[model samples]
Each structure stands twice: as structure tokens, then as C-alpha cells.
Target: MDKVFIKDLEIETIIGIFGWEREVKQIVRISLEMSFDISKAGKSDLIEDALDYKKIGKSIVNLVENSSFFLVEKMAEEIAKLVLKNKQIKDILLKVEKPGALRGSKSVGVNIFRKQ
Candidate 1:
């Protein structure tokens, strides 16, 4: 299957279990990989036949910015579900990283997969 991916997508949102976290927006970095068969789109050379990545990106950004979650795992799962909603996608891998969440560690995050 061909793959459509978006990487290093950063969004600011209120996410965390702590009260302080809920009061402030933190930057989260998201990476997504979705599987699809793009042969038809490739042959036809039509934008309509292919997945609309810009739309997806915008949707993800909106979803993240407007929503709050306590765990990165839940966030990743939600993102996977959103991506797999597209019929063209057979499977999805989503990674969300919360930078500087832990002292001395670069980031803390979760990686998850969902199949359609």
C-alpha cells in the first residue's frame, strides 16, 4: 500500500491531568502515517482521487487545539480514529509528543496504531 504521511505537526493545546496543565496551552508534536492504495490516483493524475492531506492536517490541528486530553495515549487513539475515518486508509500510526513534560527528558509521548 502507498503511504500518506504528515510529520512534526506542532499544535498548542491544553492537555494533561494536572490543574496547571489545563490552564495553559502546551506545544505538542504529532506525526502520522496512513496506508492507502494510491494506484488509481496515480494513474488518473487527479487530485480528487488522492487523499486530501491539507484538509486532514487542518482537521487534526482543529481537533487538537480545541480538545483536551489527560493522556497522550488517548490523544493518539483519537487521531488514529480520525485518520482511519477516510475509506482510503487501511491502517494508521500516530505519535504525539509532549516536549519538556518531564524534567531532563527531551519529551514524553505515545505511539499507537489502528486498523480499518
Candidate 2:
């Protein structure tokens, strides 16, 4: 299968187990690789024949911004579920990270893969 990817999509949301975390919005970076067949779009050169990545990204933005979750694991799972809702997507590799969440690390997060 071919792939479409979105990288470093940053969104602010309430995410963490800490009391202060729930009080303020924190930035989470999301990246994803979606399995798709792009031959038709490549050959036809038409929007109708292609996976609408912009639409998908907007939807993910909406979902994440409106959600309050304590773990990046849940965020990743939810993103995978949302992406897999499109029948065209056979599989998804999702990563959700919180930058500067740890003292010694650049970021901390979870990565998950799911298939339909």
C-alpha cells in the first residue's frame, strides 16, 4: 500500500494526569502515516480520486482540540480510530508528543499502529 503522511501537527489541549495540566492547555504534536492506494489519483490527477488529507487533518484538529485526555496513549488511539474511519485507509501509524514535558527530554509521547 502507498502512504500519505501528516507531520508535526501541533494542537493545544488539556492533557495530563497532573492537576495543573488540566487547568491549562498544553501543546501536543501529532504525526501520522496513513496507508492508502494513490494510483487512481496519480493517474487521473483529480481531487475526487484522491484521499482528502486536508479534510482529515481538519477533522483531527477538531477532535483533539475538543478533547481532554490524560494520556498520549489515548490520544494516539483516538487518532488511529478517526483515521481508520475512512475506508480508504487500511492502516495508520500515529504519534502524539508533548514537547518539554520532561526535564531531560525534548518530548514525551506515545506511538501506536492500527489496521482495519
Candidate 3:
């Protein structure tokens, strides 16, 4: 399958198990890779014929920013569902990370893969 990606998407939202985490927004980094057929778009050279990464990114940012989640696992699931709504997508690879969530660790995160 052909591939498309949006990387290092950062959003601020309430996401954690702690009480303070629920009260404030924290930064979450996201990355996604999905199967998309680029043949038509490549041949036609038309934006309309291609999967719109900008639109997808905007929607993801909106979803992450407006919603609260206690786990990156759940957030990744939701994101997978959102992207899968596109019939052209065959499968997805998603990563969600909470940087600085661990005191001494750089980040904590989850990765999920789903197929249609």
C-alpha cells in the first residue's frame, strides 16, 4: 500500500491519572502513518484526488485538544477510529507520547496499529 504521514503533531490537553493533570492541559505529541493510495493523486496532480494530511492533522489536533484522557492508549484508539473513517485508509500506525510525564524519564507513551 502507498503511505502518507503526519509527524510530531503536538497538542495540549488534559491527559493523566493525577488530579492536577485533570485540572490543566499538558502537551502530547502524536505521529501517524496510514495506508493511502497515491496513484490517482500522483497522476492527476490534484489536491482533491489526494488524502488531505492538513485536514487530518487539524481534526486530530481538535480531538486531542478538546478531549480528556487518562491514558495514551485510549487516545490512540480514538485517533485510529477517527482516521479509519476515511474509506481510502487501509491501516494505521499511531503513536502518542506524553513528554516529561515521568520525573526522570524523557516520556511515556503508547503505540497502536489497526487495519480495516
Taking all chains together, each candidate's TM-score versus the true structure is 0.95, 0.98, 0.97
Tell me the TM-score of model 2. Answer: 0.98
Better of 1 and 2 by TM-score: 2
55-85, model 1: which lDDT tens digit per residue?
Answer: 9999999999989998888888888888878
Report the candidate with higher lDDT, 2 versus 3. Answer: 3
Candidates in descending lDDT order: 3, 2, 1
lDDT of 2: 0.94
What is the clash count for each candidate, in the order shown?
A: 0, 0, 0
Scored by CA lDDT, what does every candidate get?
A: 0.91, 0.94, 0.95
Stretches of model 3 off by over 4 angstroms after superposition:
none
Top-lDDT structure, candidate number: 3
lDDT of 3 by residue, 1-116 (tens): 99999998999999999999999899999999999999999999999999999999999999999999999999999999999999899999999999999899988899899999
**Residue 6 in model 2: shift from native, Å?**
0.2
Error of 2 at 79 (Å): 0.9
Error of 2 at 83 (Å): 0.8
Residue-wise C-alpha lDDT for candidate 2, range 3-114, written one tens digit per residue: 9999999999999999999999999999999999999999999999999999999999999999999999998898899889999899998889999999999999988889
